[model samples]
Target: FAALARLAAELPPALAVLVGFVDRERRGERTLLFNAVALVRGGVVEQVFHKRLLPTYDVFDEDRYFESGARPLVFDAGGVRFGVTICEDAWNDVDGPLRAHYDVDPVADCVTAGAQVLLNLAASPFTLKKRGLRPAMFAGIARKHARPVVCVNQVGGNDDLIFDGTSAVFGPDGSLWARAPSFQEQVLVVDLAPAQRVAEVPASDEAAALDALVLGTRDYAYKCGFRLAVIGLSGGVDSALVACIAARALGPERVLGVAMPTRYSSEHSRRDAQALAEALGIAYRVIDIDPVFQRHLDALGPSLDALGAPGATDVTWENVQARIRGTTVMAISNRFGHLLLTTGNKSEIAVGYCTLYGDMAGGLAVISDLPKTFVYKVAAEVNRQAGRFLIPENTLTKPPSAELRPNQLDA
Candidate 1:
């Protein structure tokens, strides 16, 4: 109560503020209900709107801790009347009474009371395609009431339930005016020019997708307490792009690039990798893994030859090289206490193209969700933003290869 009073005091005068809160009280009943509604302005809260519907099925336990309130909350804000509802309010036809049942329809009451806009605040959890339903619901509400509607959602991964906070707004004509990015915290500011009715081209969906991935990477790394990220630079596009993202998110100094060359690694690849590292201004190391590979092959030569598998076979030799490189990188990661970043893209992961426990060995997969095509797109955007080509042009143009075995292309 004191905190609310202090916040209200600091807020601008005459501007209406609606706060949603859950009320808990021990009545004669043994069961509890989760209640939510608007805290009206002018120091008086008239209507008590409650969440009549509660999900008890999967990954939810709302019915265990709340007593549902029994009315629709309609309030005045900035000379335009508005209706505020909680998360489950939109799903129910009527808010029910008693410990478990209350009868009130906030949406109907808002329309009856001439609400110009309807606003809903929610902490809805994410399920596969659950977000797709929000657009239709908001659009239907706007078109039905002949008023604009705004939905604000809380976003973040909360335990087993991830709240994808893609808040959306619709005009009176049921057209989407604005939408926030998913799976992240963002404050979306939209200018409500009701008089102009000018329809601008919708923003690029690709930009939003990329931004989400970036945010996901940043948050996962930082929240997981990884201060330094190390990548195995093969002079290929995947590793280069991952290094770029890590540098951008955690600063260049925090990202370390290790160019582990072998007999198959070309001189051009090494030069390009070095150029990229210099351009990004990150710590770089050239660890030759040829000695390590040869030692392993020599040690396993008797067993490999006795098993009727030739050492020169492409598959056997390539896999041995990849495993050796993986082992070397893991050893470096353990010694230096740096987070090893795996450089496999979605295209590789989807088709099982990546060497298991080899290139896929990392604390977190940065580009696991991005396809090979999108990886290049993001790299291009990064270079475009840098003005000059910070990422080496040769790195981007050259065909990607693991360079694991001698004379072995990534076929």
Candidate 2:
């Protein structure tokens, strides 16, 4: 609160601010944290609003750390009365298969309290489906209240969670007044006026998704203090897509593509990887792992025989290749101070098809949320937009494979 007060004191007089933060307060014998928002104007905090609805499901666990607020907070700003609500408060009236857990209607309370406008501050996570549903949810609340609703949402990737900052304003008639771009930061300044009809919002789901992934990748690397990225190019859709994303995020100059091939790796696969690196204009290198793999088998064969496992199973040998590639990439990342990018798609991640210490090793998982089918879709889109095969035609048309064994497909 003191820091926020100091910040507000430094800002220009006409620019009042609503700042969201965690506030600690005494609750009986315990100290509780509240998800709080404070309105600061003229170097003074005029009013404070606490989040009433705490989402406890899935990625959110606010109920464990925060005490729910009891009342709707209304304040006068620029001679207009406005009500403030946190993320889940405005989501109460959303019609969905997901069960509503809260009974209080914060938005309704604000409207009934004579609020002319409503403001919702949110840190909503980005999933493709959840993002698509947001505009309708905000519109519904606006239509119900017969007042303009403005929402400012946080954006960026935090670990596995991605926040697409598609902050927007909606008119009382369920019309969109203004919208900020998704997955990036921007200042949206709109002159307030009476509600009026507007055109339907443009449809760009796939493009928005691509932008989200690109922003998520870039933010994750920057937050972790990485300006350079390293990726193992396997000539598969997952790795191809990951390299493309990393290049887009960090730029071609900052990305390095290393292709590690063992004896089992196909010649065409190597060609595909090299071609992708060339197209992306990223630094490319090939490290042969056959000698290292052969040495491992020779050394471990005796130990396996003594344990009544005379020969390494197919899975074990396959893991050896993966671990070798993983080690190579990690060494490169360490030596060059580059962030390592893992190339596992959502489908493989769901079923644990990837080796934990091997292919799963990376500073970031660039396309881990995209399923296998979606990975291919994105790869094709990349080529289509480029007006040529940026990822190489063979990489797209060839059957998916780990290439750990001869004639082995990714079945």
Candidate 3:
């Protein structure tokens, strides 16, 4: 309210604000807030709009934090009656992914209330499909209402959620009129009247995928108040790709690549990790974990013998190596305040191929949503785009393995 008061006091007579903010309210026995937007004009608040639809699936838990609003809100802006919809409100369109999730049509209600334009303010997360999904939905809304719809979305990575700005304006005929750049901040000025030119779609699938990861990495580090990053270099496609992304996002000077080798670690694997760091011009450190692993085994052997338990199983020993590496990397991160980037791909993470506290110990998981097969594709794309082997060719070709047991290979 304080922020709104200040803004309203200085609000230009020709302009009005429809912006989102956290709003608090009290029911009979409960006090809760709403993901809300306030309409301000000429030093006064016209209406306080609360978000009606609260998504509670996957990473979204807005239902737990906010109260649902009752109805739609319409306010005048620059002689045009604009309807306001929060992030999920505009997603209630029939053709959208979550159409079944919402029962109310907020946009339709706005149109019934005599709004000339629909303005949706959103902070929606970016999944791979959202690159194409958002524009299609907005265009569909414009065509249905016969009114221009403008969507302004939050950009940059917030933890696991990456918001691709890609803010867009769609004409009543469902033509893309203006589009902001993806994964970055861009100002788009479009005349309220019919657009004279159509907006060009800027990015391809592969390019957008790479940019999304890069922007996510960069924004996650910056927003979390860290400038330096630490990555576990395993000489596999997953870790190699993560290292490349971290170097690109945070710069070589800010990224530190650590290669931890154990008794089972192959010589070529260690060499490949070092080569990657050198090629990327990032600081590199090699830590040998054989001594540490041996000490752990020696210490635990007596306890196991006393318990008369079966000797350490394959999984048990594998976890031991992973945990040791995790511990070492975490210690370095704590000492230097470098945000550790975990390198487990989606395929490994999905089937529990990774150790919980071991390889998964990091401030960020860069490629956890990416499958193992796609990891190679991204690595190849990276090299192809750079016109050289940014990641060593051997790393890309070798069969992936944790190297915790003898003659082990991931096929």
Worst 10 residues of 3 by lDDT: 195-204
lDDT of 1 at 373: 89
TM-score of model 2 relative to the true fold? 0.94
TM-score, one value per model: 0.71, 0.94, 0.92
Candidate 3 — which residues are off by over 4 angstroms? 26-32, 96-98, 193-204, 302-313
344 Cα displacement, candidate 3 (Å): 1.0
Ranked by TM-score, top first: 2, 3, 1
lDDT (Cα, 0-100) at 367 in candidate 3: 89
Candidate 2 deviant stretches above 4 angstroms: 27-29, 97-99, 194-204, 309-313
**Strongest candidate by TM-score:** 2
Deviation in Å, model 2, residue 83 alpha carbon? 1.1
Residue 354 displacement in candidate 1 (angstroms): 1.3
lDDT of each: 0.71, 0.85, 0.86
Clashes of each: 12, 0, 0
Better of 1 and 2 by TM-score: 2
Tell me the deviation in Å of residue 109 in model 2.
0.8
Write down the TM-score for model 3.
0.92
Which pairs clash in the backbone of model 2? none
> Considering every candidate listed, which one attains the maximal lDDT?
3
Query: TM-score of the candidate numbered 1?
Result: 0.71
Badly placed stretches (over 4 Å) of model 1 are 1-81, 85-115, 122-141, 153-169, 174-206, 310-316
